[model samples]
Target chain A: MRNIRIAVSYDGTTYHGFQTQPIGNTVQDVLEHAIRMLTGEQTSVTASGRTDAGVHARRQVINFETSSPIPVNRWALALNSWLPGDIVVLQADEVAPSFHASYNARRKTYRYGIDTSKFGDVFERNYRLHYPMPLRLQEMKAALAHVVGKHDFTSFASRRSTKTSHVRTILDARMEESEGKLDIFLTGDGFLYNMVRIIVGTLFWVGEGKLSADDFKRILEARNRTAAGPTAVAHGLMLWDVEYDD
Target chain B: MRNIRIAVSYDGTTYHGFQTQPIGNTVQDVLEHAIRMLTGEQTSVTASGRTDAGVHARRQVINFETSSPIPVNRWALALNSWLPGDIVVLQADEVAPSFHASYNARRKTYRYGIDTSKFGDVFERNYRLHYPMPLRLQEMKAALAHVVGKHDFTSFASRRSTKTSHVRTILDARMEESEGKLDIFLTGDGFLYNMVRIIVGTLFWVGEGKLSADDFKRILEARNRTAAGPTAVAHGLMLWDVEYDD
Candidate 1:
């Protein structure tokens, strides 16, 4: 058996989520179905992480073991022929048999977009959260400054998260505002379920003057899910990139 | 009655087209429906021009006379409350009583996007034409230079057009290539039905070495629709802007 790794990008608006579900269509289900048709083998594909419904991914790494004799580099073109227009395979490579898409990941980056235009951008409505209200960018930046470095991240995670450890290290957190839009970028060693969304939600509150930079720090230290703001909508968030050791 | 002129933007993927149709919902139908709901008046709307199905508009000028007491500046906000997410009212103004959206237009600009990326762009699938094949940008540019100035563009217009005259002045024609995408921008005093799309299709053929720069001029002079290449798909085209005399 050979472990094949592939980088994929998808527009998740019409998908249920990255993981397979008992009901409704998902990115995983579509990929697996495409693979089954291509290789004549029913194989389970594992991803770096599962994204919520309506969350896009610029680059999501996944791995699956297959006994097919097809060249490793030809996997992307082969699978793309079977996949829908919303999902695209970027590249494919052969990896060591022990490599795992989920467990072997080193860091991940996520981006959240907020459209502040009064009338909103119609073409990008599906990709951004339309928050027409004015926001204090400097205050939001100050709040983000408190999010860097190691923290428990329990307050930023979803209440339904069942992870054994709530601790995570945030490598970087920053915001970019331009052309009536605000984008937040966060990079971390690992994230709990809905962690990035909750963090962005809290930052929005800070920008709205509902909370101060100090309050963001207190929320992080509180390590209580209820202490943080609500989770931002899934459509506004995107899994940008995942990094692995060379 | 006030002649309310509104600048609107829409993602046209879901609509039938810009004009009213008997069987399907169109941008005009939706706008009239929303206006009826907002002002309780069943009034028809006039646009600078009609765009085909799956074609987007960055700024489409439309006008409708209304007896509602709402302020001109408030029309945008009020109408937006009733419009769907894919369509937006950007601005509203009380134009001259005799001003017409279609008749008063002086010039128009249309843009067509061609994505030359290897795997195509999933996020922009609806907004661009995915042509992974190599294109000769210089050759395409040389062909576009022949498009400028006045010409009888019967070969570029759709055969279904009933216009008496085919002469039109192209103010400018240019191409921009970057990041694996080539964008064609054409500004003209006026265009016939599917003129921009047909021109783009012919340019694609030129880029692929199927046609030469001199052949394009010859085809324009041929004064026959069949002399030109096939009409490009509607999804890659956008009504970028329109101009009217003050």
Candidate 2:
């Protein structure tokens, strides 16, 4: 069997999520259905990770083994033709059998959006969290700086995380604002389940004056899930990019 | 009875347009239902203008007579409590009995968005027209300049327009692009049926080298609906704002 890797993009607004549900609408179910219609093969696709409901993805990498004779390069256009308008196959690539979509990933970046505009933004109402409260950008930046570097992210992970180890290397983190639109970016070698959302929640608390940089560091050292802030809603989070060693 | 005016915002993605439909879901149907639930009144709302299907609105001025004793300032918050998340009341005011939502309007501004990036923007797929083709900005600007000021807008109007007079005054028109997102802005005293869509379509033809700036001016003077390019789709057109004499 040949291993085929594909990069997919989707608007997760009305979707159940990237993972397959028992009978709900999901990105995976739609993609697999499209592939079956075109190639007459029922295959399971392995994705980089499971994105929660309402969490969008700019490019989510997935891989599957298929015996279809169609060229790998043409898979993108063919699959996109059968897929729904909300989900699109951005690109496709042939890879070695050893190239895993999740375990072999090197880095990933996530973005969280906060709309701080006093006036409601009608067009972006579904994409970002509308937080009209005043925020201190400098304080958020200072707190974000402390989140970078290698550490145990136990406090930032969800209670349902089945991974044995919580240690991860956060390569970079930053915050920027454009006309009351705040963007928080986080890049890391790997992330625990709900790590990005929890981090954003903690940063929001810091910006709201409910926590400090020192308190965030202490929570990280505590290595307890209860020490961290609440998780941000899924609608405001996006899987921006995922890097895999070529 | 008091004449209550309110500015409303809505995401028109799933709506059948601003007008009330016989069966399908519409912005007017939803807003009227919400108003009925809040005030127990079945008054008809008068809007500044009707937006086509899939067209959004940032601030659509609307008014209706109501016997509710709630303060006008608090109606915005109360009405929004019952409305769906996609539609929101931006502001509310008690207008004079003579104040009319449609007839008292002096100016209206519309914004059309174009996604010029090579790659598909997943988030903006529904809100913008994905036109990856190369466009000449200078040519589009020059064509837009000829469209400004007073003109017989018969060529720029839809064939289905039923207005007695086709002459209208375009106050301003401009084009701006940032980060591969192009925005065409137009302001006018009023517009004919589908005038903004046709204007954008004509400008698009000019940018693509299909029509010159001089040809655009000639087309305007032709006073014929068939003299201009096809009308653009309604998804990219947004009623940005409406001005009143008050």
Candidate 3:
């Protein structure tokens, strides 16, 4: 058996999520279906993590074992012919037999986009969160600065998480603004369910003057999900990148 | 009755086109329906021009006569509440009684986007044309430069056009490239049916070295539709702006 790793990008507007489910079509379902048609093997593909419905991905990593004789580099070209326009295989490579896409991931980066323009752009309605109200940019930046470093992120995680430990090490957190749009970037070793979306939601409150930067820190220390703001919509979030040890 | 002029923008992926058709829903149909719901008037709207199916608009000028007493500035917000998210009224104003959207227009601008990346972007699939091949940028620019000034555009127009004269003045034509993507901008006093798309199609031939710059100029002088290249797809084109004499 050979372990094959692939990077993909998708416009998740029509998909249920990244994982295979019994009820609805998903990114994994389409990928595996394409693989089955190309290789004639019933194989399972593992991804770094799952993204929610309407969420997008710039680069998502996946790994699968195959016994086919096709060259590794040709897999992307072959699979893309069977895949739809909304999902594309960016690159494919042969890795060690023991490589695991999920467990071997070292760090992941996510980006959230918010458009504050009056009457949001028509072409970007599916890709950005439209928040027309004025925002306190400096306050939002100050609040995000406190999000870096190691912490128990229970307050930012969704209640659906069943993990025993909510502890995760955040490597970096920052925001960039241009032309009435704000992009928040977060890099971390691991993330819980809905962690990024909840963090962005709480920052919206800080930007709206309902909570101060110090209050944000206190909420993180509280370690209660109710202490955070509402979860932001999923369409604005994108899986930016994934890293692994070489 | 007062003449209300509105500038609107639409994604155009879901609608049939800008003009109302007998079989399918269109941007004009939606706007007229929204007007009926808001003001109880079955009003007719006139646009600067008709866009083909799947063509987008960044700023389309439209005018309608309304007997309802809604203020001019509030029309955007009121109409937006009744319209879908894909279409938005950017601004509204009270214009002169004799001002017409189609007849009084002075100039119009359009933009076409092409992606030459190895693998096209998923998020921009609906907005740009994906042509994964090397292009001769200098040749395409030279070919486009000859398109400026008044000329008989019979070769670039579609066979369906019934106009008596095919003469039009192209004010400016240029292109800009960034990160494997090219944006072509064209401004003119007017365009015939499918004129801009046919021009882009001919330029594509020049980019691929199938035709030379001087050959493109000769095709324009031929004044025969069979001498020109194919008509490009409509989804990559956008109505950028419309200007009228103040």
**DockQ (model 2, Cα):** 0.47
Q: Which order, best to worst by TM-score? A: 3, 1, 2
**Chain A TM value for model 2:** 0.97
Interface RMSD of 2: 2.2
- State residue A163's C-alpha deviation in candidate 1, in Å: 1.8
Docking quality tier of model 1: high
TM-score of 1: 0.98
Number of clashing pairs per prediction, in order: 0, 0, 0
**Which regions of candidate 2 fall more than 4 Å away from where they truly are?**
none
- Poorest lDDT segment (10 consecutive residues) of candidate 3 chain A: A118-127
Off by over 4 Å in 3: none
lDDT tens digits, residues A1-246, model 2?
889999998889999999999967999999999999988999999999989899999889999989998998799889988988788888999999988899888999999988887555767777788898997678879878887998999999999999999999999998878986999999999989999999988888888999988888889889998988999998888899999868
lDDT of 2 by residue, B1-246 (tens): 999999999889889999998876998888888889989999789999999899999889999889999998788888888988889898999999988899999999999999997656777887789898899899889989998899889999888999998888989999989996999999999999999999899989998999999998999999998889989988899999999988
- Evaluated at residue B246, the lDDT of candidate 3 is 76
Residues A116-206 of candidate 1 have per-residue lDDT tens digits of 9998999888889999987888888988988899889899989899999998988998888899788999999999999988998998899
- Candidate 3 per-residue lDDT, tens place, A23-80, comes to 7699999999999999999989999999999999999999999999999879998999
Displacement of residue B85 (Cα, Å) in model 3 is: 1.7
> Higher-DockQ candidate among 2 and 3?
3
